[model samples]
Structures are given as C-alpha cells and as structure tokens.
Target: MHCRPCEPRHPDAQRGVALVVALLVFGLSAALLVAMQSEFTLFYQRGSNLFLAEQGHAYLRGAEELATLALVMDHDADQSREQPRDDLGEFWAQQATPYPLDEGGWLVGSLQDLQGRFNLNLLAATVTGTGEDGTDSARFTPAQAFFIRLLQALPELQLDSREAIALTQAIGDWLDPDTITRPFGAEDDFYSGQSPPYRAANRPMASASELRAVANVTPELYRALAPLVTVWPQTPAPLNIHTAALPLLRSINGDGELVPLSEMEAEALFQRQRSEGGFASLDALLEAPAFADKNMEGVRSLLGESSSWFLLTAEVEVADRNMRLYSVLHRDERTVRAVARASGSL
Candidate 1:
C-alpha cells in the first residue's frame, strides 16, 4: 500500500504519556513508604510494652525479696526478747514507706499476720465419738464452738444459733471425705441440683475464697467474712491472742460460760493489751480480770503467743505500668519463704 510520509507525533502527547507513568510510579512508592512506616511503628510499640512488662515483674520480685529479708530480721529480733510475740506493734506489721526505684517509679509493700485470723481448715477436723449404741455421735469441738461464737459476735453477719450451727455443719460437710449430710448441712446431693451442678470439695480448702461455694455464704457474707479467716499454713495453728481482733478474742470460751465481753469491755481489754505491750503468755491473759469467772477449759488450746504465717502485698509502679503482687509467706526461727504468690488484684 502507498502511504504518505508519517508526521512527527505531538510533543504534548508524548510528554503526557511520560508524565502518567511517572505519576503511577510516584504513587506506588509513596504507598510502600507509608506501609513500611506503620510496620516500624507497631514493632516499636510492641517492644516497648514487652520491656516495661519485664521491668515491672523484676521490680515485683525485688519487692518480694525485700519483704522476706525484713521478716527474717524481725524474727531474729523477737528471738532475743524474753517474750517473743507477733502483734500490730511489731516491725513487720507496720505500714511500709514507698521505696524509690532506679527507673523513676516507686515500690511499696506491707505484711499482715495470717494467724491473726481464724483458720477455716480447723473445721475440717472430725469431732466424732462412739455412743452407747456403737454409732458415731458428732458434736461441736471447742474450735467449732469458738467459730460459732465469732459468727454470732459479728453483728453484721446476724447469724443466730440455728443458722450458725447449720452453716458450720455445712462447711464441715464440704471438707469431710463423706457423702453423709449433717442434720443441718448440705452434701453432693444438695449441690448437684444447682443451676450449674457441682460437688463438695471433700477436702481442705486451698483458699478462703472457696467459702463462696458453701451453703448460706452469700457474696455479702463472704466479703464480711474473708478478712476474718484464712486457709493457710497447710497445718492449722492456734490463733495469736496478741494479734487477733477483739471479736475473735471475745469468742474465746468453753461451754456453759457466761456471755462474752461486750463491745465496751472488749475495747478496754484491747487498750490494756496494747498499753502493756501485749500479753506475755496465755496464762497472763487468763489472769486478767476479764476471765475471772469465765470458763476457759477449751480456750487455752485455741490461743497462741506467736505467729508463723503472714501475707505480703507488694506494689510496683514503673513509668505508666503498675503491678501488684500478693504472697503468702511463712517465717520460722531459721528463715522465711514464700509459699504462694499471685499477680494483679487478688
């Protein structure tokens, strides 16, 4: 085919084609740069968070160590004294001042005497004896009686004789390795009928929080009761008369004893104890006018002068990160150790 000489393409059209290609390349490069920037930012934040978490944990562990050392020192000091006892006045029981950290934060810790509270595991103990018919007869032991008295004394709980007895028996049933229910207690048969069925532990409780699962222990009751009881020491120990609250103190007595000290009288006794640097021995406590006429045959065995179990709560703050540690520590004449530990609010 015959064709005319081709005309040169317009410079503007050629320039436009080149410009489009440049623009596409520019857009793609910009998008790629933005994506890379976002990825870098995310990695930076993740690493920063991880570092802070590790630092916070280290500080908490350090706090635990410091608490253990303080307890040991306190034990050494008490050994030198003629009357060794743990009380609110002891060094370990005092509120701790916040310690400054190297990384611009503070650490705080405090110790509470676990023995100051009633040991719930004591109820798990069997108090049965053989009757004339050769059948096992169950009765409230001295410890159980003291628990009943404590429940009655707590005006907030408002548990009367019948209800208190039922609750105590229920707790016992939960702990004992048996399916037989007490006259006023609940067993697997009772629990299996609940909305989400469950059974009795049939063993000692690992934590006081387990009380919530028992019969008649409402949330309100648990809140009021948790502070006054403990499930620790693996083996139960006597309540420290020097450290026990007035309510627990008033609960100490045997059967056929008169009504316990009124609030006013108990307060007087508490004040006297504090002023006299706590009781030197259980006998000294009994000799006080408070027990002149009160029957105390079962009381002596339930009282002690010293404590071995304590709770250490440690808090650490590093920059914007805050953490808390709860540790159950056991102290002895030789050393101190943490038996249980948890992080966050307990």
Candidate 2:
C-alpha cells in the first residue's frame, strides 16, 4: 500500500528530548556511584577501627605474657617490686615504647609497680588484736586512719566523720564473708536494696575501681579514693619501696592527722628519693617526726618491706591512633598472675 511520507518532527524539540533523557541517565549513574563509594568508605573505616582495636588487644596480651614470663624466669622478681631487670619484664619497667603497626601505625606498652598502693584488704586490721576483748575495737588502724584522712584531704571530696565512718564500714562489709555487723558495717541487706540490687563480692576487690559498686560509695568518693588504694590477691605484700607516691608516705606518717608534711613537701621528698635511687630504707622515712612517733611494730605489720603486686598502665600510639590498657599483675615465686585487664582507645 502506498502512503504519504510522515511530516518531519521539529529538530530542536527532538534534540531536547534526547538531551533530557541523557542527562537523567547520567545523573542516576553519578548518584549510584557516589552512594557506592560512600558505603565502601564507611566499611573501610569500620574495618580499620576493628583492626586497630584487635591490634591494641594483642599488644596488651603480649605485655601481660611478657610480665608473666619474667615472673616465671626469676626467683626474686616480684610484681610488687620495681619491674625486674630481666629481658621479659624490662619492656614494661621502662616508659612506654612505641611499636610500629602493619598499616603505618604503632603500639606501646608500659609496666608499673602495684606495690605503690595501699592494700585495701588490710584496711580494717589492727597492729594487734590485743586490746581489752582480744579483738580490735576500731574499724581501722592508725595507719589506715591516716590513709583515710589523706583521702579526705582531696579538695574534690567533702566527707564528714559520719560519711567517712560509713565508707570504712562499707568497705569492710564488702570484703568480709559473713553478714555479721561491725559497728559501722553495711551487709547484704544494704546492697540488695539499692537501685541494682546486687550481692556483695564477699572477697577482696580485684580492682580499686570496684569500690564504686559498694554501698553508699559515690563516684566522687570513688574518684577521691582510687589513687590511694589497690586490691591485690594477698595482704601485707611489701609496699613498693621505690615507687610509693609521696601522698602514701605522708599517710603512713601522718598518725591519722596527716600532719607531718604538706602535700608539696611530701612530693618533694619523694622526688628527692627517686632522684637518689629510691629510698634505701623505710627508716629514712622516720626522719620525719610523725612517722618516728608511730608504733614502729604496727607500721611494719601494716606495710610490707617489699612489693608483691603491680598495676601496669600502657599506651600505644600508632600513626593517628592511640590506645590505653590497664592490667593488674601479681607475682609469686617464678610466676605472674594477671588479676584483671581493661582497655580503651582514641
């Protein structure tokens, strides 16, 4: 069949439709490509973070193992003592050393003597149980009293006598097994009624930070108390003769009043000792009158002549990443025990 030719369409109009379609296709392709690229970037970042976290964890474990090996190899190497001079424990004994990571990063580890802290387990004990009833009447010894007093001195805290007494009782209750009441103790009844309703640890705290879980312990109080105390697997471990902070020595000498020296004075003394290769003997501390007057026998009983526990705080900086870890280690004859581990990163 014969047909007339169709009229030609407007050239500009036809070109305009084609151009609009092409533009739409191109816009959709660009949007998809952008979306895909964004998703890939997010995945890569997340994976990198996870890898870094894992690397930090591995380095922390490596530190712990190295400490353990030191304990195992040396008979006299105690966690409470300064990090021993052996190869394994030496890494932590020194300041943090950065280790390079696989992807332009680094990791670092550090070790610190836990003996520098007061043993919280000994808080309620006395020089002797030999008063009137063959039982210690006071909840805390003079040494412990001094320690608590130092804790009270922190400007951030405002604990009255009653609150202080309550805290002492709470800590004692948290450690002791039986529900029996000491004069100011808080038992299971006290904690079971709290917001979370938890049971007592009934054992010594694994970490100083555990104080937050005890009854009536406020975060402020915990913050105030944390720097001064530690929880080791055992009691009466030798206090770190070398690393004990000046505040602790002040507490030891203060006779519950913390009167012997100002904080600055105490720090200065400690710095002097550290500069002079640490204290040769605890007797040097007696040069201060407050410590001199103390019952020497009682002080000796409460504080040890050597160290047996350590807290190792380490930080690793790799490229743009930084990580921190806290580890509690206990040393026995030829063995190191890890009590706890915690980590964070930035």
Candidate 3:
C-alpha cells in the first residue's frame, strides 16, 4: 500500500497553540511587575523610617543647645541679683513640664541640681572603722553620715541603725584606697565571691549604680537610695532645699541622729521652699525653727541658693521614632557649658 502524504496542519490549531504561549508569557510578565512594585514600596518605607530617625536625632541636639542657652541666660539673670538662688520660679526649673514643639515632636527637659544629693564619692576623704582599731579604717564624712541618716528615715526599707551603719562602712570600703575590709564592708574578696566576680572600686565610684557593689546594699535599699544620693559632684555638698526630696531633707542633720524634723516640720519646710521660693541665704534658712540646733554648721557652705552643676534630659518623639538626650551642664557665674552628653533611641 502506498503511504499517503501527511495532511497539512489546520490553521485554527496553529493559532490556538500560539494563543496558549502568549497567555503564559503575559501572566509571567504581570507577576514580575507586581513583585518589583512590592520591593520598591518596601525600600521606600525603610528609607523614610531612616530619614525620620535622623531628623529626630537632629531635633534632640537642638533641644540640648536650647537648654544650654536657657541655663546661661539664667546665670546672667542671677548675676544682677544681690544673691542668685535658683528656685522653682526660675525659667529652667519651670520648664520641667513637657511642651509641644513647633515641629511634629514634643520636647521636655529638667534641671537636676547635682549638689542636692549626698555625694557618695566623698567616702574617699575619710580614713577608721570600729572593728579595725589598729589598722587604718575609713571614718565617716558628713556625706556618709547624711546617707546613714537618710537610710534610717526610710523605715519602709526596714534598714535599722546597725544595718545603716554597715551600709555606710561598706560604701566607704568600696571607695577607700586601701584593700582592707571593714567588719561589714566588702572589699575585692567579697566581690570576687559573687557569681560574676569583680573588684572593689578602691576609688571614687563612677556612677551611683556602683552602690550595688557595696555589701548589704540590696536592690530594695538601692531603689530607695538611688534618688537621694549621688556619686557625682566629686566633693561633698549640702542638700538643696529647692530640689531635695523629703528623704534627703530629713537627713539634713550633721550629727546623723534620725533627722530632727517631724513629718509636719519637714512638710512645713517643703511648703515654704516650694511656695515662697528657696532661701536666698543660709542665714535665711537657719532662721527656721527646725534648724535651731547647730549640727548643720559644718555643711553650711554646701547649702546654697544656686547650683553649679545640673543634669538636663530631653526626650523627642517623631513619627515612630523616639530619641532621648542627656546633658550634664556646669554653670558658673558667667556661663554654662556641657560637661557630658549621651543620646539613645526609645
């Protein structure tokens, strides 16, 4: 039988195959376009977030400069007065409340008098402990005594007189130059015994948080003490009546006998200082009946109407970004300068 020639393919069938291939190509192109658009959108959002964050940081820096300007102006204004005493009525102190920024974010800053808190670093100045009669031990300075009295005032912390004394001794040991340990205080040995061992500072504490390194300074006690005491100011200073908390004010005595003032008496002092502005002079402060006793004599020079050092904190929020800036300012009779600055995101 002769093979018949193959029949020619129909035109309709060829057209159908071409249509199928065209549909596949179109579908693939559409999918690729959608993916590219999604990637572009994601990249744009990331860049926008980065821009806003940088803008927030810039705003924070501006806020810091404004704070410095305000402080310098405050000093200039104080120069005109017979006695320059910073008080709640002053512009810097009054600015503690948050204010809306002309920009999209808000700004808030406050001045914290460094000298208002007991200086923990002063323990380095003293050198005798009850346990070490022969060896050189640290004698409590007025600042340490103030801390002890402050501790006694916090009955809620349940720290008795003995514990308070021990805490003081421990702090002294941590700060003292010698490695000799007191009866209650911890030296390098005590710290080395912990889970993560460290050594005694054997020097001035860099931060108030270092108090946790001292013996008998539990988290509870530390929490109670953090706001009232400080390792800054280097030298000892007296409590600033304008800015002192009740616990610190109650520890105003030099003799360290559970602060002499009753609740009403303390409250009265707070009321006058808060309402009538702080005392212009130590003599004016001494006029109060609560200060009838002269136990506070040694600390008079520290009790001042004006502060030399201050901490300013500024927080700014822009869109989804939050920024916080911390500035430590040193203010003198003439000008204000930033001693330290730190910033971070929230």
Candidate 4:
C-alpha cells in the first residue's frame, strides 16, 4: 500500500517562481551598483574641487609675494600712486601674468590704486564748516562736491540740488562722531522718526555699498556712487592721484568755478592720461586748456603720487571653473601687510 502519487507540480508555476526570484536579485544588485557609482563620482568631484581651490589659493599667495618683493626692492616705490613704473620703476600694466601651475590654467592679477576711490573715513574730517548759527555746516569739499555733481548727472537718480546737498551733508554726518545738528546731518534722533528708528553710522563705512544707510541716500544714488567710493581698513583720506578718475580730476580742478565734465569727456581724459603714461605732475594736468585755470594745488594735495595701501583683484581659471580673490595690502614702514582676503567661485 504505497502512498498515492502527489499531484504533479505545474512546470509554468515553478519557472515563474524562479523567474521572480532571479529578477529580484538582479534588481537589488543593479541598485547597489548604481548607488556605489554615484557616491564614487561625488567623492571624485569633491577631491577635484579641493585641488583646484588649493591651486587658486597658491596663486594668490604668489601674487602677494611678488607684490611684497617689489615693495621691498624699491626704497622709493610709492604704492599710493598707480604709476606706470613698478618697484624698480619698470612698467607693469598688463593683465594675466603667466604662473607655474601645472594644471593648465591661468592666473589673472591686477593691482588697483586704492587711492583712486574716496576714503569714506575722510568724509567726516573734510566736511568742517560752521553754519551761520554756529552749527556744523555740510559744505562739500572739492572731492565731495565732485561726487555730488556726478550723482546729479546719473539719469537714474531723481535728486535736485537741495536734496543732493542734503544727501552729502547726511553722509558727512553719518561718518562724524558728535550728534551736533547740521542742516543735512542725521543722528539717532533724526532716524528715530522713521518707521524702523535706526541710528546713524557714526563711523567710517565698512563697505562703499553701505552708503544707502545715510539719510536722503537712495539705492539709485548708492549705485551711481558705488564705483567711485571705497572703504578700507585704514583711515579714509584723499584719493590717489595716479588712480583718481577723470571726473575726480575735473572736479578737483574746477573747484566750484566750473561745471563738471560729461561722462564722455571724463572718460576721454582718463584714457588720455593712461595712454600718455600717468600724469607726470599735477602741472601737466593743469596745462590742459580745460584745466588751465582750475585749482591744481588743491588737486595735488588731495591726490598724492604714492600710496600706502592697495587692493589686489585676482582671477584664476582652471579647466571650466573660475575663482576670484580680493585682497587688501598695506605697506607699513618696510613690510607688506595683507589686511584681508576674500574669495569666490564661478
């Protein structure tokens, strides 16, 4: 009495089960492989980016070294002016100096005369006049006057003479210490009237863009003036003569006697000076008929031929990536000091 034959198993069912298990295993392995590959690629990219960034940093350091060496070599080298001559009085006006980076990229470095821009810190010291009533007066200096006129020229800003003057005074007040009243000056009291109730800066601006905080200064005005002003870690003073813009030059010469030049004329003069190899002296500038009777002495006093501080902007490109580095250098006695360094990628 052997056991009866079990029902025959279905061939298709067995094959179907086998197929399902095989598919599940294959799918899991494939998913794992994809995940591993993705992680590996991410790691590789991270390493590559790190390497490029290191190279960029090295290039920037090299620039600093070169600038320092130049400063040391020339006892008479003046960083204040963006002269055509380098430390040894050699010309240095080209961009994109070659470097020894083996990664097949270029380092573009430029030394800008920080003196070209108005020292925001100086605004307080320069605006020194008492009103008829013994209060601080917001009269403009030659440079500030020029800056205001330039603001007026910008079609984007809709300010009139009174508003422009007020804005100028407000900026001065913002940088000054005392809260004493000036026609255009604003203090905590004045700002308290606004919805937000902010206080005046009462110190040098940390950045040129901060001008928007001053009373009567609109974004439009700030944008117009941004190109001409700068805030360094050091005290704000007169602009560098070698780097001063043409508008600044015209303003210095005109000294409230004549109207400021058009943008085109200003740019033309700037190009001419650059082409002719920076103004040898303020006299040469005054010799021009446009500046013949303009105030040359004041201009020279405000813009010196040498600079103690400078701003370096460098761009490094590797493969398809680009990085920009901004550094501030200060020459103290015989040493070159790096005040700050900022980097960005694109």
Best by lDDT: 1
RMSD of each: 3.3, 6.1, 4.1, 5.3
Tens-digit lDDT string for candidate 1 (244-343): 8777877776454323566776777778667775776789787777677766777688889889999988888887678899999998775888899989
TM-score for all predictions?
A: 0.88, 0.68, 0.80, 0.72
Model 4, span 1-346: residue lDDT tens? 8999899889999999999999999999999999999999999999998987897777777877776665555535444546423221233334547564576877777776676766766556555554344422235565556555555555566455567667767887888787875676677888889888888878777777678778877776677677667787456555655667655654454555324566666666677667765667655656766666555554455666556677778777777678888878886667888888888997
Model 3: per-residue Cα lDDT over 155-180, one tens digit each? 57856667787887888888889998
Which runs of model 4 end up more than 4 angstroms from their true locations?
1-19, 73-102, 126-161, 177-181, 185-199, 216-220, 253-301
Worst 10 residues of 1 by lDDT: 130-139
Clashing pairs in 2: 80-307, 80-308, 80-309, 101-105, 106-318, 114-310, 238-306
Give the distance in Å from residue 307's predicted Cα in candidate 1 to where it truly belongs. 1.4
Candidate 3 lDDT for residue 92: 79
- Model 2, stretches more than 4 Å misplaced? 1-52, 62-94, 97-102, 124-139, 153-155, 158-162, 254-272, 317-321, 333-339
Residue-wise C-alpha lDDT for candidate 2, range 31-76, written one tens digit per residue? 9999999999999999998886787677767767866665464545
Better of 2 and 4 by lDDT: 4
Q: Rank the candidates by TM-score, best first.
A: 1, 3, 4, 2
Q: Global lDDT for candidate 2?
A: 0.65
